[model samples]
Target: MSLRKIKRPQGDFWFDFEAFAEDEDGFWLRGPVGTPWRAPHATGSSEVPVVVLLAPGRPWAAWWVGDPADRRLEIDVCRPPERDGNGWQYVDLELDPVLHETEGRVEIEDWDEYDESVRNGWMTADDAKLARVVAEGCAQLLHQRSEPWLDRGWKMLPDS
Candidate 1:
């Protein structure tokens, strides 16, 4: 899915590079592309679905759904025949549900926001489900650390 506006009932909202609200300190947080807050975190060569979850006591989690951005902007995940699996290439996946263990339960902070967005027609039902899938997948990955998502660190793609 291409980048679209992300809204939440509280806290800062995502306007896809446009400033939706003033910065917390009333200083500039946006850039020529979009919010700098999300710039460093962007990991893809083309437009791809992603979910980032920030935990109070745990590390912030990132599900680079499909392709991992690394140092390059490999955001464009293509169809099966064109995909090369150089990155996490789950082309059919969308919605990124971010999950982490919290007091023995998995939690995702944005479900409410997604629900609200879907109800208000700002977001589609499929996208919301995509995000939820990410969360579920993340929980298993975090617990087992057995697959590709196990790597918590990022390596910049050469020439990105």
Candidate 2:
């Protein structure tokens, strides 16, 4: 089987088409492409689903959801509660639980020291059940593909 390739701003991250969020309702809105903050995070609650990309400790973007029936899922993108100036600050992402339940919180320290690079201190809480389902689906897509690494410039070696 041939590996299917999709073009993303940051070069091309390998992902199965079927598993990737391709629906028009789904989109990735974050910092510039190739940036660490460049992942499609949360979905919206409005008639149109919005895909948000949050900064490490700053609230940079928001994707609006226009429809309640729309399914919004946020991936791993949360920081730690941190100090801003006079008090501590944290990032909170909330969605309509009845229609979509994708809530994420990130702790932060001082606004200046706030950075996504520090991984240990931060925690990303996603729907365990939903994560499992998405993981399984991705695995199945990989199984169906043949040369999944072709896009990565991998070739068969001969001799020895």
TM-score leader = 1
Write model 1 residue lDDT over 1-160, tens digit each, in one string: 1222223322222223222222221211112222233222343232432332122222122432323332211111111111122211122222333323232333334555556666876545665564556556555555554644233222211111
Candidate 1 — number of clashing residue pairs? 20
Q: In order, what is each prediction's RMSD in angstroms?
A: 14.6, 19.3
TM-score of 2: 0.19
What candidate 1 gets wrong by more than 4 Å, as runs, is: 1-106, 152-160
Could you tell me the lDDT of residue 151 within candidate 2?
A: 17
lDDT of 2: 0.26
Residue ranges of candidate 2 with Cα displaced over 4 Å? 1-126, 146-160
The lDDT of model 1 is: 0.31
Please provide, for model 2 over 38-125, each residue's C-alpha lDDT reduced to its tens digit, 9 standing for 90 to 100: 1244322222323332223432222223234443332221222233333222232211112132332222122222222123333233
